[model samples]
Target: MIIEQSHFLFVSLYIFAISIGGLLLNRRNIIILLISIELMLLAINLQFVIFSVFLDDIIGQINALLILTVAAAESAIGLALLVVYYRIKGTISINKINLLHG
Candidate 1:
């Protein structure tokens, strides 16, 4: 089985579409929104790796690693904020977040 550039592009597009749908339609759930953001990041990372492989370039891999690190940090900070919000508000609903006056 030989994988081509088109295959990578198709898969990346599919992931991006699903992630956007998740972000737009699941606005009430903060966790789903966070997961969707991660999915989008993964899709970008996939494209980076695919292009790097096809072009024999190391910069793409380095860029992907940087993105991965940023994604990890983002997720960690987001989850920590979510936990604090849940502890203070007792709910994880995005709609209810605005009740915090500060």
Candidate 2:
């Protein structure tokens, strides 16, 4: 019971940190956005592993692997977008690239 509670607390704190980081740093830095996304993904992965271990099931591990693949793809796309935006705007600052009115 104690272990489960601790896991819940840890996951909650990680999610809260990710949310706060995303909200506060979205306009200030693109890297922070990436980090925040990774943090959120990590929390999900942790939860999956915990549940898998608790249930003695392998499905959670498989799901976590899938999530990791999705995260990699997401990061690749995000970085690609950032690169394109930087090429056009000459900066990677998220606040300065608001020219998406196409």
Candidate 3:
């Protein structure tokens, strides 16, 4: 039995679509936005690895590693900001973000 590259491609595309939908549709919480972004990155990484394996090329894998590193850093920074915002505002909801207008 063998799995085709298009199968993995379609799976990754589906994941990307869900993540985008989550980001666009869920606007009440900041945490969910960050999570959706992470999921999108994961989908991208999955696509990179799938293509890399299918093409027998290392460049795609390397790109995936770089993206993984960026995702980790982004998550860390995002969490730290969330913590700070929560401490000051005592809530992680995006509705209160209008306070930044000052």
Candidate 4:
């Protein structure tokens, strides 16, 4: 079974689209929003890897690693903030988000 770049592209596009859809349609759940954002990052990473392999270049893979690192940091910070907000309000619902004010 030989896999082509187009197949990887379609997979990446599908993941990206689904993540975007989840981000837009999900309003009340902060966790879902975070997950969607992570998925988007993953999708981008997949594209980066695919292109790197297809082109036989290393830059794309490096960029993907950088993006992955940033995504991890973002997830950590976001989860931390969410924890604080939940502690203060006793709810994780995104009814009102004013972390600084709270």
Model 4 TM-score, 2 decimals: 0.92
Q: Write candidate 4's Cα lDDT for 57-101 as tens digits.
A: 999999999999999999999999889878988888877765556
State the local distance difference test value for candidate 2.
0.81
Cα lDDT tens digits, model 3, 1-84, are 788998999999999999999999999988889999999999999999998998999999999999999999999999998899
Candidate 1 TM-score over all chains jointly: 0.93
Model 3 pairs in collision: none
Pairs of colliding residues, candidate 2: none
The segments of candidate 1 whose C-alpha lies over 4 angstroms from its true place after superposition are: 99-102
Root-mean-square deviation of candidate 2 = 2.7
Full-model lDDT, candidate 3: 0.93
Q: Estimate the overall C-alpha local distance difference test score of candidate 4.
A: 0.94
The predicted structure with the larger TM-score, 3 or 4, is 3
lDDT of 2 by residue, 52-89 (tens): 88889999899999999999999999999989888988
Instruction: Write out the backbone clash pairs for model 4.
Output: none
The best-first sequence of candidates by lDDT reads: 4, 1, 3, 2
lDDT of 1 at 67: 100
RMSD versus native structure for model 1: 1.4
